[model samples]
Structure formats: C-alpha cells, structure tokens
Target: MKLPRMVYNQPEVVQPVRTDVLIMSPWLAPIVWDGTYNLGILNAQYRQRKFRVGITIFAIKKYTVFVKKFIESAEKYFMVGQKVTYYIFTDRASDIPVMNLAEGRSIAVLKVPSYPRWQDVSMRRMEMIRDSSHTRFSHEVDYLVCVDVDMTFNDEVGVEILSNLFGTLHPGMFGLPRDSYTYERNPQSEAYIPADEGDFYYAGGFFGGNTEEVYKLTNFCHKAMMVDKEKNIEAVWHDESYLNRYFLYHKPTKILSPEYLWDDNFGIPAFLKRRRFLAVPKNHDEIRNRR
Candidate 1:
C-alpha cells in the first residue's frame, strides 16, 4: 500500500535585511564641501564611535571650487574603510568621483532625476537621501544624519549631538531653532510669530534619527509638499517650519539645543547650544598657545 502523502515543511530561514549609513547634504554653498578638513574632525569623532559613516551630496556637477575641494577631500580623506562609504547622488554620475572615495570597499552612486521649483529643489534633497536610505546599502546604518554641506565640522559637533540624542533615543525628533524670523514682507508670516513666544523653530540644516523615523519624516515632508501645492502656498523655506509643526503636533521626542546647529553666522550663546551638543573646548595649552 502506498504510504500516506508525506507532509513537507520548509525550514524557517531568517534573512537579515541590511542598512546603509548616510549623512545627507544639500551642499548648496561652495564654501562648505572641503572634505579633508571636515573629515579630519569627523574621523576623529567617528573613529571612536561604532557606526559606519557616509556622506551624500546632491548636484555634484554644479560644485564650485569650495564644493569641489570638499568633495575631493571627502574622496581622499574619507575613502571607504570597513565601515564608511561616500556617495554622490546626481543626475549625471558618469564623471563624478564615486570610485575615488569608495577606495577598495563598495561605493554607491545614485542618480536621481531632477526637478524645478524651490520647494521641489528642497524635496530633491530629501529624495536623494530617501533613495539612499531605502537602497540595499541602507541596512548597514544604525542611524542616519540629514546635513547641510555648507556647515563645517569645526569639531565633531555632528557626532557629539548624535551621541547625546542616541543616549536618550526617545521616540521624538530634534532640530535647530530657526534663525529669528523677522519678515519685512508677508504680513501673514510676520503675524504668525508673537514677539514673546520662544518656541523652537526647526531649522532644516541638520537632523537625524533611526532609519525608521527618518523614513517616516521624509515621507511626511513629501506629502506635506503635495498639500502645499494644493493650497498654493509658495514659500520654499517652509520645509523647516513644516517639520517644526509636525514634530510639535505629533510630540514624538524633543531634543532641543543650539549646539547641534548654528546658522552660517548666527552665534547663539555657547551655553544655550551646549545644552544639547557641546562645542569642543580649547585645552589650556591650546588656549595659551593662541597668539
């Protein structure tokens, strides 16, 4: 007699999904891309940390001397190590320095199609990051930083801020207060701010979080843009405001400090910024060494 049909069960195999570490940057200003100088400090900070670090620059071909210098510096100083990778996301990746930075390890070059419009331009910034964040390489990153290329790492302010936030890794969001908004036009924008109110005005320059939160935030930002389109609001600089609104309304996690973020020249008191991210203090020798 034929034996009863045997039942076969497939073995349960677990496939670990991977993630990539990305530092998203708009690099709009040419002065901010000096890779070697920035990397010297970034490396010092990250060398002791336990995460892979990589940078993403949008529209690399338009890079000026400052931008090119930074890109080249990043290529030379931040070349791929076991844990780091540098990515250049542009419409044309053919001649861009994707390989020079990859060194021996795998370097990624992602070409995202372009668009027009100020808000759309900012959206492109997020798109480059989102694309990289969701790619196969994304799984390698425990966390990701959305940064502005113009900002330099005078010290490892990036890592210091991240360390503080990671230590408290609450289910919340963080950002720099907007440079005081004193609008000469648009009564609506002016009336929007009360003179005495000191609510945090999220600056879009830098922010980061677990890959999951970042994905969610970017997705929200994209959808919000669609809403703005429908409503015919044309202010392109409102991305940061949009984020500030979302975080305030949602009340995820609040990491508020200026140390983590300072505008090109807006010098908020060091103590205020230091509450969240500390500036590297000058040692006695260095202080005395200063002429």
Candidate 2:
C-alpha cells in the first residue's frame, strides 16, 4: 500500500518554549537537528580552510541528464563557497556536460563499467566506492558524500551537514513507526533488522561522513553484500537494506532531517520548514527497466 503524502501549511505564531525547540526521534535519540544549527558560524568555520569535500555520484547511460541537472543545481546551492570536487562515476564520461564552477569547486570524471540490470548498478555502487576510496579518493579529499544523481540541491547544504558520520532520514518513512519501516525482515539475509529495534530508516541515496568513516562504511556494506550473494539472497531493497542494518549497529554521528532529501512529487510537510535538497521526479520504470 502507498503511504499518505505528508502535508504542510504555515502555523500561527506562539510564545516560544524551551521544550518545543528540542527535536527528538521516537526512540528519544537526538536524530533531527533543524533549528539547532547556525549556518553562518558553520560556514565561517569551514570556509576559511577550504575543506576538501568530495561528492560521488554515478550516472550510467540514460541517467546522464539527471547528472547534468544535479551539477547545475549543486553549484548554485550546495556548499556554495567551499572547496568541492564532484567525482562523477559514469560509463560515458563524455556525456557529462560542461558547466561553469565557482572558485574552489571542480569536477572529475571516473569511468565505471555499465551494468545491464539496475539492481546490479545499485548494489555494485558500494563495492566501487570502497575500491575507489583506497585508490583515488583517499588522497584527494577530507570528506566523502555518496548521493544519487537524480537529486538537486534546493537550498544551502552547507557545513552544518558534515560530521564524523551522517545519514539522511527517508522522506517517506520518517514519520512511521519502527515496525512499519520497510527494513529487511528475513533473518537469513545479512541485512535483517528485528521488529522491536530501529532509530530511523535512512535513505540510501544520500549519505556521507569523514573520509575514513565513509570508507569503512562502504567496505562494510560491500562485504555484507558479498555474503548475501554467496547465499543467493538479495535483500528487499538491495543496498538500502544493508545500509539500514549498518546504521542500526553503528549509529550515525548526525541525522539529517527529511528536508535534506524531500521528493518534489510530495507536498512539503508542516514540520519541514525548509527543504535543502529535492529528489527530482522521474519515470522510475523507464529508468530502471529499460535495460
């Protein structure tokens, strides 16, 4: 069954309460941090050093158009003044469009073999990232962000999102109970999560952390996927299932609100006053099934 669309409208002004400012998850962990950050302070602290931020995205074949849009939007709204390098992994690097970049921002194309199945493309991302970290990424950047190509930065996604480890709350599952979350439930699979335990179902499409931590995460997920493959068992959501299991045992240092990965197709929720990034609507069947 499809979930209801989260809706939002302006609220009436009221006297502020100290308790009202605190953002907590159902498990009572400090998961969401919307108003708690000061962007000016964060930007001032990180921009001075020009922190080397690496963004990794895959745009194999037909998805190149989405990458083009992502690059244009990211330059305008994502960490605008920071030192950022987009490590674009694609089969056809020549398809990447040329765009003007701000000072301290640039792009590098990494050629990856094309996969026939979308599931293979999704699962292989973890392995490729882990391999790339050791060979190329480790020597190039301070932090690494793995994100889907079909998304665009809608607002300032600045230093506030950075940490030792970070995960974005899935827009569709953020409000649901743990049991209702679409986690891999089979015990036989490496990505299983019991019904009684979970903090949040993080979106696999957007996540990042310190260079070392992200490398470890990619390595861990790759190993887990290999184990599942040996048993001929694929999790319900492919790599996403493994990611949920990883975050369960190894909690993220920070949890980004749904604002970071809202779907443009859904109406804004009242709690999400500002949307930092938006998933561009696309024909999922065409993109995933064409092969």
Candidate 3:
C-alpha cells in the first residue's frame, strides 16, 4: 500500500491511511500457542472498531493447517472490507487450504527459509515489520503495533489513545508502569535499570508506536538480535527487552499507566486500578472486594 511520507514536526498535507495493526504469532498451532486466545479477543476488538487487521504467522510446514484455521476464523468476525494478511514464513510450499481461500481476498502467503528452532523464528516477524515500515509506508504509518499473538484487549483502543500517547509531552514507549516487587532482572548487564525512577515496566508482548518511532525501535532490536546471533545466544526474546530499554533511554516512548498493557501476575496496585481506568478480575475480585 502507498502511504504518505511523514516529516517530523511538520503536518502532512494528506491524512495517511492507517492500516490495520500488524500482529505476529510465530508458532505452528498459533491459536493454541502462547497468548493466542488473547490475540483472538484483541483481534475481534479491533475488528469491532472497523480497523483493518493484518496478521503474520510464522510457522513450520506442518503447522499451516492450524494457521489456515486461525485466519478463517478471524475473517468470519472481521468486517467485510476489513483486511487480513497472513504472511506465512516457512521452508517448503504450504499444503494447507489457505491459498484456496486467499484468491481475490486481501490475504496473501509468503514462504520464507526455515529456521533452526521455532523459538528463534521471530526473526521473520521482525523482517516483515521492518520491510513494511521501511518500504510500504515509507516509514510513515500512524501506529504500527507489534503485539504477541497472546495478548487480549479488554477495552477499545481508539485513536484517542494513540494521539494521547504520541502527542503527550512524554513521547516514549507506552506500557505498564514497573513495580519493584515483580521486576525481572534486567538482562542487559551493561544497561542499568534504575530502581524507583519510573512507575512503568513496559510489557513487550503488546506495544506499538508512532510508526517512525517504532521503525527506529524495531531497527534497534534487529541489530541487537544480530549481535546475539553472533554471540551464540539463540533465543533471547531480544525484541521485547530491546524495546523496553530503547524507550527507557531513548525517551521517545511515553511511560503511561499500566492499564494499557496489564499483566495478571504483576500489574498495577489494587488502589490504583480504578484511578488508571484498568480492570483486572483477580485484582478486583481479591484486592478490591476485600476492602
């Protein structure tokens, strides 16, 4: 698709078309994979808003069956004109029935070289986003979201949130504020995560951006992953962690309330839940009800 070229600090003459959010699910049976159900819920929510939804599935040859089923199910609920692109990355030609359904539809299949392990397969997803951002839109998309196939949306994320997050004074990574108790040890030995400096701990599984910023962030992640590859660190979840630190130091990602990207195990405090307009059943059922 041809997207408008964006100039920093300069308003565009034409309103760039906001393509559907791009979600990556790299696995054989993605629906049954991590956060797959949640992704379905979130995809349904996006379709409800009439937003175009494009999904890229990274899987092996045998797993094409499940991928086809997942795409068909998504198409059932999505609006008629709403688009869904299923970019399949695999070694051999796909035997699944996806191609039969894809003719004359927005959906398309792309077969890529196979990777050693399924976990290390995210490289394909990274490449897809990078290529799309750099070439397709000229790196000028309104919001290029990269969410794990597992995350579910509880509320409608309208243009308002995108405007607020990107237009706010603090334009950086938007995610759940970090808490001292649940902090995962920072993997970057060279990079020190200051304790108590900020309230947000970014969740990599669900994060997006002003397209330009996201491009930069993902570019950084790709480079970092390349380094890891050289160092023999095969599956480091580099994309997620790189994004967290990139915004932490780059400061383009605005640190926002945790509700935007909530975690059931470690998330916003009970008292702060309502304050932030976030609802978690466990937190509400246990923490608020007790009070």
Candidate 4:
C-alpha cells in the first residue's frame, strides 16, 4: 500500500509525551493514552489498510433498555470512518433498536438465550465469543473488539486502540498497589493468581485483539470456566477474574489507560485528559434482578 506524502511533524525520540503515567509496559508494549500518538498519522495509516473491525456487545433481558443509547453514542464516537460491524448478541432481536448508522458501519444480531443470573450473563460472554469467533468473527473481520453494553462512548475511540492484542486498565484498580488488586485468590479455580502475582487488573468491559489472538484468549477463558464449573467452583469476579489471570501470563501487545474504561461512580481525575468510554450508572439489584 502506497502511503501518499502527507505533512505531519516528525516524532521526537528525545521528548516523551506523558511523563507522569507509564508510557510503556515492562514488555515494551505502548500504554496508550491521550498525547501518546498523533491521530492524523494513525488514522491515515489504518484507513489506508481498509481494516474491518467487529465490536461485540450483549444486550439481554433488562439490558435491552441500554441498546438505543449505546448505538446512538457509538455512531457518534466509535471507530468513525472505519468499516465496523457491531455483532450484537441478544436474546430478543426485536427488542434491539434500529438507528441510522454512518457509512461503512452496520449491525448484526446474534440471537442467544437469557441467563438466570446476571453473573451467568456476564461470564457466558467468553463461551459465546469463542463460538462466534470460530464460526463467524474470524471470517468476517480483521479484529474483534468486545465491550459491555451498559456503557456509552464519550470521546473518540479510533484506530489508536487497534493492536495485535489489547487490554484496558480497570478504572478502580489503577494507581493501587498490586496486593490491593482484586485478582482471584482461590487456588482451586482456574482464575486464581497467587498473592504476589499480577500485572494490572484488567476491565473485562473492554478488550480486543486480532482475530487469532482474541480467539486464543476467549478459548482459554471459556475452557477455564468450564473446568471451574465441573469442580463446583466459581471465580469471584466471573469473566473478569479469568481475564486478569490470562493477561498476567499472556500479556497484551498494547494496554489502554483508565481513560478508556472509567466508572461512573468516580469523578474524572485531573490527570485524565479524555474520558473516552464510561459506565452508565445503574442500580445493580434493580437491573440485574438481584432483589
């Protein structure tokens, strides 16, 4: 692919972008944040490739109410100008709302059954994604990005996030000591990480990789959940626990800062330049039917 001559400032190796936050991981992977990379350069590089990105989101039962807002906000902020296919997994396809999507963006509904518990609903995503990756996602898209449906985009989530494999920092878990990280501690479950072991507790709400890497990840997590089920053990945080354990060993090619996955409960800190994607405030007991 011939990249046309374009005027942009040459990157200076001596001067770093954000001195406060860790710009690079121990493994040399870039920790993405605002001011880290030039969007013009990234957009031109990726847009020329004509990449196909498929984002997976699940809206089932009570979660259906979040669909319209998610789609509307997504249309305004997510992967603008890229070929995006939102593979929405929902029990009730009719309940999924329709909206005017932008050019090169569309939606595909994958009908699934509703789970009895909200925990099951969240944990089952690994299995659902694994199966879909094998039969559908692999052939349809170059990359698979997954996110929780209950959240909405607040800022640009563009090609800057695309990588061979990527994980977002858990908003509540960041800036805390490793010991304080809520990694699964049960030795019996496959999601267990030893007391002294952990890199970063990742947000399961958002993560992705190329088709092959995502397949390998979801496959491992799904099978681990099955083993725990057979032994009558469930990890403390469901899919998120499994995800943390996986990233601990596997490591991601790129890591997104907390800006990509902030909780609605917390105020945006001064250090954060962009509040990209955020959790929509909701009552846990009321929405999940915990009552």
Candidate 5:
C-alpha cells in the first residue's frame, strides 16, 4: 500500500537531525527524539496501513484515580488518526470515567484483582499483560504498548513510536553511566546484572512492540518474576528491574529518548526538547502504602 500523497520536508544526507545527543544506539537501534524523524511522514505510512494499537495500563486500587486524565489526554494526543483500544486493567472499572473517544478509538476495561501492596500489584502486571496478549490483544491489535497508569500524556505520542520492539529511557537515569544504573545485583535473582554490564536503564513505565514481540517480552518477564519468588528473592525494582534485564540481552529495535518519559524534577535538560508522557506526582506513602 502506498502512503498518502503529501508534501513534507526534503531529506538532507549530510545534515544529521540530532547532533547534540546519541541518535542511534551502539547496536544500531534508532533512539527516537524530537528531531530524529518526521512525524507527518510516519503518520501517513501508518494511516495507510490502518493498523490498530492496544495500550495496556493497570489501575488497581487507588491508582484508579489517574485513569480519567490519562485516557482524556491520550484521546487528544495519541495516534489521533489511527485505530486505538485503551485496554484498561482496573479493579474499579465502574469508577473509570466515561468519555467520548475519537473515531476508530474505544476503551475496553478488564476487571483485574487488587493487591494489598502496590509492589505486588506492579509485579503482577507482567502476568496480566502476558495472559492478555494471546487472549485479547493478538486478535485485536497490531501493536501493544504497556505503560504505568500513574502517568499522563503531555504531548503527541504517535505512530512514530510503534515498532517490532521498543523501550523508553528512564528519565531519572538518563545520561548516567551504566555502572551507576540501579540494576539488580544479587547473583541469585534472575534479574541480576553485574555492575560493569548494561546498555541503558529502560523505564518499564512505557515499553512495547508488535503484539508478537510484546507477548514474548511479557512471558519472559513474568516467568522470571515467578522464579525469583520461588527463591524468596525479589528484584530491586520488581518488574522494572526484570524489564531492564530483558532489554540488556534483547536490545530494543527502537529506543525512545527521555522525551517519551519525563519527570518535572529533571527541569527539561537541553536534549529533552519535547516532553511527551510525564509522571503525575503522588505521595508514595499514601499511594503505595509504604512504611
């Protein structure tokens, strides 16, 4: 199929789009940033394909409060002209606010069980998504994006982000050396990574790929978590740690710059020219039931 006939900026072979930052990983995966690619061109290609995307998020217990704003913001800024299904996994599906979705967009809430501790809830998300991949997503969507429910879209997160496999750089860990990354160090845990070895600290909050690839990612992550549990050892950041381990070996086909996952605390560094998805500040003590 041909992309929509349209006129956009002409490409320049000698002119690199992003010179201030690393636009490509050592392994050659594209590191997506503000000036890296033309969104208009990418959108036309995906629009012609009429591909469907399933964005998965878990809002168990009190986290359900964030669902409304996230959904409303996504409707406005995410893949505006494409088909999307917001696959919301929430304990309080009834509490999710009702809003009129755009053309070719819809919401599907799967009532999930609530856990007492927030960590357990976070860890279980892998299994939940892993289970849904075959049961719901494979049949309905071409791509599956998994994100943390506590965040909201701050700008356009469109088809330019879709790929066979992709992961976002953790805003807090951006530009930090690999040794400084907070990887799970325990030799026994399946998520372990030696201090000297690591590529990038990927944010589990926003990661995905085509349904087939995402299914393998979730399956491996969920299984690793189970193995750790059997040994009575939990990875430092639970699912996030396991996710980092996954990427350490299976490099993402596309790596999203910190722009895709930012926190206000970072104060918008020069490289982070555009902020897309941002963290919604919350009192960890109150929301996560921390001591």
Candidate 6:
C-alpha cells in the first residue's frame, strides 16, 4: 500500500502545531522534527493497516553484544504496536539473543560472511542490503530501516519516521556550516560534493525508506564504492560520504532529528532535551582493531 506524501509547508497562518520541529540552521534546512510528531495519532492511523516494516542491522564479530542490547531496547521501545521484523544479518546466527517479542513483532536471522577489517564490513553492508532487499526483504516487508547495531532505543521510534525516503541529521555535524561538513571533496570520486553545496550531512548509522527506495539507495552506494575502489580513492568517511552525496541530489521525503540517533557519549545539548536512541560508548580501538 502506498503511504501519503508528507507535506513540507503549510499556509503561514495555520501555524505548525508541533513544536519539536526546529529551524536552526542558516541553510534553513528542516533539521530536527522532535515534538512535531504525535505517535499516538500516527500509531492509530497505521496500526489497522498492518504495514510490514523491516529493521536491518549487521553485527559481525565483537558487535554481537551490541546487537543483543539493541534488540532488547528495540523490543521494548521501537515501534511497539506495529508489525515489525528485525532482519539480523550476522556472521554467527547462533549469537542472536532469544527474546519474547510482542504480538506483531519477530526476528529473522540471516548468515553473512565475516570480514577482517571493519571498513570492509561497513562498506559491504550496502552491497548486502541491496542484494538482500531484492532476494529476501522485498517479498516480506513494505518498508526498511537500516541502522548501526551500536545504538539502543531510549524512547518511541515508530511510524513517525516512515517516508518514501528519510535520513537523520548527523548530531555531530548538524550545527556546523555546510562548508564545514566532512563530505568527499576529491573531484575524482563519485561521492564528491563541493564545499558550497549540501543540505545536511546525514549520519551513516541510521536511515530508512520504503523497500524499493532503500534498495535503490543501497545499490547506488555499492556501485559508487566500486567505482572508487577501481581508482583507489576511498572517501574520507566511506559509505557515509556517499550517502551525503546521494541525499544532496535526491532530498529525503522526511528528515529525522538527531534525537533519532544521538551519541550519549557526547552528552545531550541544551536544544536536545529528548534523545530517542543513544549510541552507547564503545572502545573503538578494541571493537574495530580487534577484527
């Protein structure tokens, strides 16, 4: 079933009833939409429809512990009343934690090969998701939410985020000027974005959309990375740089606030009173270097 397209702007006099939507940046890009969404209303609207939503995560090697915490938090807080499926892509399917899911929620474990380097693991995720969306997910789910396993939900994460295409503002870069964004600057790479052009630097850790749109995004990123591989030109931030490039040309239908993917290690800012999911602090040296 096709979802309604979200209206970006309304008549000036009508006034936005939702105060969580922030217009802070000089670019005037709608960065955060926290209180703007009423999940109760959205839940009631979609609950009867029984939309099949797929949440995909990769937890190779040491990341298994994180997956456990993520799923625990997700089962309790993520899309609580909706029809949701956790598509866990892991090298060790046996490591997936067994949990009692709510009535309409379930888990699907798919085995993937382990990679030696974390960078390769991150880059290959795009290819795997793209291929699997066609082979596995498209047949089962209507929408797909791809996220990093290192985070856990702290509040409601429901249909408010659903759109034809959506991306979350990188909490670290949302306050920076467009030119300060860490976009791929090299002219030779397919992910290159000029310093002057960028709506927002979206986090690579979380993003989602309808199954078909997400498949297109993943496929595009995978192809771009391959082109960079041939030229021995890796973007400064790997797949993330490619994602920023993609959204610059094709703006997302909805832009989630940093609240959706915050880093608790950084502490909450004054403007951010509520954080939906927090990235638990991890010893990057240990997790990434061990592999």
Residue by residue across 1-291, what tens digits does model 6's lDDT show?
A: 665565444435567645544644453434446656555667667765758999999989888889878989998888877788999999888888898889988999989998888888999999999999999899999999999998999987888888888899998997789999999999999999998899789999999899999999999999999999999999899989989999888788888888898997677787786798898888986987574
Model 5 Cα shift for residue 276 (angstroms) = 0.6
> Where in model 3 is the C-alpha error above 4 Å?
1-57, 60-105, 137-142, 150-199, 229-236, 251-291
lDDT of 3 by residue, 179-221 (tens): 4423324554322345565434455544555556666766776
* Model 5 C-alpha lDDT per residue in residues 230-282, reported as the tens digit of each score: 99999999999999999999999999998899989879787778899999999
TM-score, predicted candidate 2 vs. hidden true structure: 0.89
Which ranges of candidate 4 are over 4 A from the true structure? none
Distance from true position, residue 9, model 6, in Å? 20
Runs with alpha carbons beyond 4 Å of true place in candidate 6: 1-32
Candidate 1, residue 232: the lDDT equals 62
TM-score of each: 0.55, 0.89, 0.50, 0.97, 0.97, 0.90
Task: Please give the RMSD to the true structure for each candidate, in Å.
Answer: 15.6, 8.2, 13.7, 1.4, 1.6, 4.2
lDDT at 16, model 4: 85
lDDT score, candidate 4: 0.91
Candidate 2 or 4, higher lDDT?
4
lDDT for position 41 in model 6: 63
For model 3 the TM-score comes to: 0.50
TM-score, model 6 to reference: 0.90
Q: How much lDDT does each candidate structure score?
A: 0.44, 0.84, 0.43, 0.91, 0.90, 0.86
CA lDDT, candidate 3, residue 167? 15
Off by over 4 Å in 1: 1-50, 64-67, 71-82, 98-107, 163-198, 250-260, 267-291
Worst ten-residue run, lDDT, model 1? 27-36
- In model 6, residue pairs whose N, Cα or C atoms come closer than 3 Å (at least 3 residues apart or on different chains), thus clashing, are 20-35
